[model samples]
Target: MMPTIVFGVLSVIIIGFALAMVLSKNLVHSAIFMAATFVGVAGIYLTLSAGFLAAVQILIYVGAISILMVFGVMLTRRGDISASNLFNKRIISGVVVSAALFIILGRLILTSEWFPSSFSVPESTVGPIADLMMNAYVIPFETAALILLAAMVGAIILAKGARRTR
Candidate 1:
């Protein structure tokens, strides 16, 4: 009973945040909403008993990726918030393509065969994943983190260097 309620709440959060992210005009607000959506997804993963995936979602998406997006938006933003997210000339074409894809997906789903799914995912996935990350893959993980940090630093430097002269 409680799990169901929790799942419902997480689902609502995810949907709301995703909508806010997409519709937000302010880039920073959109990035923050995206981060919130990622957090909501982590909560859903928790409800599914995938603790490791939930943690990774929080760390990678919410923490690292969202921060990167927020920084990129902030650094590159030139005009006022109201001027952001304007409809492009391709809006009509984009809408038409999106509607066509949606209709195709709807038809595929409605016509798909539903078999009673009996799939088994190994319960000990987290154990082996942790073992590999901590032991054999530690250096690679650290190297990746170092590369991300260097990339972020380089981005900041480049953005600052391109500042227009008055």
Candidate 2:
């Protein structure tokens, strides 16, 4: 009972923070709200007994990505409040596309008949996960690292160029 109540509260916090992020006028404030949403999601993951995922969510998303987004926001000179006219052209199109996708997904879920499986996940999945990451997916993981490195280098170059212009 207590767990359910806690889960519900966390869920509400997550949703509220996500909405706050979208509605925030300030880009930097939006980034901070997004970080709050990420932290809330990490808490929800903890409630679901996914400790590892919760840790990764907090560390990678809330810690690294949120910091990067804030830094990117700081690098720009744009003011906090954007005019309503900024989204005038594509709003209807975006809404229609999203609604269509939602309808399709809802239909698919409702029509699908999933069977109950007796199979259960292993109690110790961490070892296998690490093994797969190190052995099977190492190349792809390293490629992602290389891509991030390139992005970091590009950001540095752009910062340098801006400094020179000033």
Model 1 root-mean-square deviation: 4.7
Model 1 lDDT per residue over 111-164, tens place: 999895486666775997878888999999889999999999998888778785
For model 1, the stretches where C-alpha displacement exceeds 4 angstroms are 1-12, 87-89, 114-125, 131-166
- Each candidate's clash count: 0, 0
The lDDT values for all models are 0.86, 0.82
TM-score of 1: 0.63
Model 2 C-alpha RMSD vs. true structure (Å) is: 3.8
Residues 16-50 of candidate 2: C-alpha lDDT, one tens digit per residue = 99867866667777788999999999998887666
- The predictions' CA RMSDs to the true structure, in order, are 4.7, 3.8
Q: What C-alpha lDDT, on a 0 to 100 scale, does residue 142 get in candidate 2? A: 89
lDDT for model 2 comes to 0.82
